[model samples]
Target: MKLRHAMVCSSNQNRSMEAHSLLKRQGFDVSSYGTGAHVKLPGPSLREPNVYEFGTPYKHMYDDLRRKDPELYKRNGILPMLKRNSSVKTAPQRWQENAADGCFDVVFTFEEKVFDMVIEDLNNREHKLMKSVLIINLDVKDNHEEAAIGAKLALDLCQELEAVDCWEDAIDDIVAAFEKQHKRKLLYSISFY
Candidate 1:
């Protein structure tokens, strides 16, 4: 079956967007989201993060950061990331804030915490459709390099799932094989929408 997919992370700036770009290019019906209250990007110090509201356009972030510290943002890769994000979508989206009209067939989260948040959000919503969504978590560090790696791994898993006749029936075997091949344990939970 052709599945609708969503990639989720904390801030929707790094990991999710990375996978979002890749999945969209590969022609998968995909969307991305974050569970954070505010979109946060790395700043000059660990204690200080450049924060923006969820609806703030990525282009604004890109320009704001460039104006703040062109050299630093460029060196840290935040500028490039914002540029890519702008190209993919208008702005960062908050998963919790989005009362999504439709449900995804499969949702992928880059961290266990994110997975928990997604599941919790789904549980809190009314199950009007009664459609089950497979939520999978693969722990990936919140960094540019790790995001890239995780995106590719996510794509691999998506391709594998798409190759199967019925993912719901073959999910167990597919997840097991994927774990064995990638040497990464995945946590999955099913929820209705």
Candidate 2:
């Protein structure tokens, strides 16, 4: 089976960026972009809390997988010619063509800006491939915050779809929540697709 497509969008690479990385590690075909696409310069606004630098570790994790996983891009010869220009590239004004091309199963927006922009754009477009898109904001707090945010985001994602009987993953978080809230693990079936 093909892996599901997931996209994450956030303003200034922070919590949302972190979630994007973790999702990719969990084996989803994921991509992340920032909401600062129109910014002409990298400045104070980005350094401020909640702002993440474009192309920084905040948005893409595991330390430059392009270099490490050369095999994945061998056919395109992309691994060897890593460009330093990406350090300052503008985030996309909208979700990229690939996502719109019907390759994605879901898209998650981390901040209000991204959700407002991307969701409204998608909702207005007439694309048969745009099946399900979710816009959600994570409630942020203190230190150890990354792990807290990551875990909760993952669990919550599994829960939301499970509530509607729409996911097939065997997440203990979702299963247990159903048992606790609905009082039955045996309530539903027909596999999540």
Candidate 3:
């Protein structure tokens, strides 16, 4: 059976989307989600928050941000990112509220907070429903550049997991390997921002 995966981050704009793209391109069954209350971004003024709800269309958000502050959107790479994101047919999803119909074989999160949230949610489920999923958290920053690197790390780890026979039975060993690789990547890579 093919393994199903999910990638999660704060806004579902940067890290999770990047990983989703890479994993899908590699022919893995993957989905991405955000854990934020609403989609949030740096807007025209640093003080102004650009927020969109879970179901808001990416193009709409892009256009609104462009209208609000063309210069700020352009400078932050939000315009191009939104353009690409729009093609993916993704809307923001709060992890706590969006229950999975079918459990994922593995779930990758971009930060500790998201990891904790996922763990808590899984813990709340029945024991049989929780035992099959493996959650791995990679400590990547919420920036475009770091997202790109995180995608690479996620892809490598997924590919490694794919090669193993009965990976579900080897969860602990696989997670340990993932953590070691994650740490090695962080140590070798330069500063995120």
Candidate 4:
């Protein structure tokens, strides 16, 4: 069976988008989200972030950034990331606002704080379906290079999960092997939908 997957990060800009692009390319039934109140992108200064509502289109963000400071945005890799994001989905989605998206078999979060928020959100929702979702956190630095590497690692884990006949039965062994092989600690929990 093909497992539905989600990649989550704080802003849904760098890390989540990278994994979303890779997983979608590999033919996984995947979606990506941010666990933030609003979508934010780096601006000219640390204090001045480019913020947008959750449903704002990636194309609009791309165009706006390009118009604001093409060279700076391009140099910072924001333009390319937004362009890639536009091709994948229409806009950035917030996890809290998208409970209607239903349950994913596995939701991979790139940061611990995002994992916590996802869990908290799940806990607060009614579990009409009573379906279990595996939420895994693999701490990744929020940067282009780290996102790329984390995306590859996430794909490998998904492939491993896909190979199993019954994921719920084999998840423990799979996760243990993955941790041993990658030498990266992973935090995972099961939540109901």
Find the candidate with the highest TM-score and give its number.
Answer: 1
Candidate 3 structure quality by residue, lDDT tens digits, 1-193: 3576545444457888888777888888777788777888776666887878887888898889889888878888998888877776656566666744546666787877777777777766666533466677778887899999988988887777777887666656766776675664221111100
- Backbone atom clashes (below 3 Å) for every candidate: 0, 5, 0, 0
- True-structure lDDT of candidate 1: 0.86
Q: Can you write out model 2's per-residue Cα lDDT over 1-193, one digit (the tens) per residue? A: 2336666655534444455556655666666565554322222244632222333331142234444454553333222212221332323323543245544444555445565666666666676543444444433332235534643565456335535544446434554664576443321212111
Report the candidate with higher lDDT, 2 versus 3.
3
Off by over 4 Å in 1: none
Order the numbered candidates by lDDT, best leading.
4, 1, 3, 2
- What overall lDDT goes with each candidate model? 0.86, 0.45, 0.71, 0.87
Q: What clash pairs does model 4 have?
A: none
Record all residue pairs in model 2 with backbone atoms less than 3 Å apart, i.e. clashing: 12-51, 12-52, 13-52, 167-192, 168-192
Candidate 3 TM-score to native: 0.84
Q: What lDDT does candidate 1 reach at residue 184? A: 95
Give the candidate number with the greatest lDDT. 4
Error at 62, model 1, angstroms: 0.7
- The TM-score ranking, best first, is 1, 4, 3, 2
The residue-by-residue lDDT of candidate 1 on 111-134, one tens digit each, is 888888888988988999999888
Q: Encode model 4's per-residue lDDT on 12-124: one tens digit a residue.
A: 58999899889999988788888888998999999999999999999999999999999999999999999999999999888877755567888999888888988888888
